[model samples]
Target: MTLIPRGFTLIEMVIVLVIIGVLAVFAMPDLSVAAIRGQIKESGPLLDVAKQGVVQGYGALGKFPANNIEAGIPEPTKMVGKYVTRVDVKDGAVNITWGNSVNGSIKDKVLTLRPAYVDGQPAVPITWVCAAAPVPKGMVLTGVDATDMLAKYVPLECQARAATAP
Candidate 1:
């Protein structure tokens, strides 16, 4: 009787490993961008806080706040989180600057969240437009856009919004 091998040959195993290595090389950049994207999200709570201040200011003053003090939030430079170095309220927009132990790829990048509301309607709810995201029809976009991060590093929703713009 003849005996046959029951397992993969050493040459075949090496070839499989080489294929895996090549695939990983292509995936590394996307995976790194995903990690940096997560780091950007770590500042969401901070952004939300700033948003509240802007909305409240609009509610009480019948208009959006022009700066942090008017919005009742801390100064931009004074605000700090694990990965966020600053959060600025600019003309009713929240501008978050990433840094302070964050990944080097995202350091010093700014992400803007501008409030959108129906023109001439103070009671209408405010919708936030991220980065350079498109605003809903009939809604007015407030504040200057300050987003400077790479598109791949922004949130998926932010990208989706931009993609749907006219």
Candidate 2:
């Protein structure tokens, strides 16, 4: 009687690799999306920094910082951690610009934080309304605004502000 070979054949190995390759192809997009979500979550603290800068500036200078420079927020050309790009303060609103590191759809969009200072007095509990910057170029969007597109990602307080837009 002849001894039977038990090792997997080269053909079987190749087939298994191909299956794995196909599975990876299907899984890649989901992984990318999860990564983007993580990145978004990480941005919360960065945004808080911007908010703190504005609030402190208002408290000390008796008004909002004229621009990002006055607010002490550096304008970044590239992504840093969850903050994709620069943090701008203008007109009592702090705008955080997203860079290429963000997901394709939401990339380059701006998240604006408007601190409620009625009559130049800081509101108790420091109320802030989140807003969206104007849409950027190359996005073939119509009828809907940036706030609408980014609604899912925006914080709850900002969602109400976006919805009330005239």
Best-fitting candidate, measured by lDDT?
Answer: 1
**Model 1 Cα RMSD, Å?**
3.4
Residue pairs in candidate 2 whose N, alpha carbon or C atoms collide under 3 angstroms: none
For candidate 2, write residues 1-166 as lDDT tens digits: 9989899999999999999999999998767656655666578777676667766776677766776666666653422555467666675566667764677756777766665533533443345666553322322111112232355655544555422111
Q: How far is candidate 2 from the true structure (C-alpha RMSD, Å)?
A: 9.1
Q: Candidate 2, after superposition: displacement of residue 139 in Å?
A: 34
Candidate number with greatest TM-score: 1
Q: Cα RMSDs of all predictions?
A: 3.4, 9.1
Q: How high is the lDDT of residue 125 in model 1?
A: 81
Candidate 2 CA-lDDT value: 0.59
Residue ranges of candidate 1 with Cα displaced over 4 Å: 161-166
Per-residue lDDT tens digits of candidate 1, residues 71-139?
Answer: 999998988899999999988988999999888988999988889888888767888888977888898
Q: Model-by-model lDDT, in order?
A: 0.86, 0.59
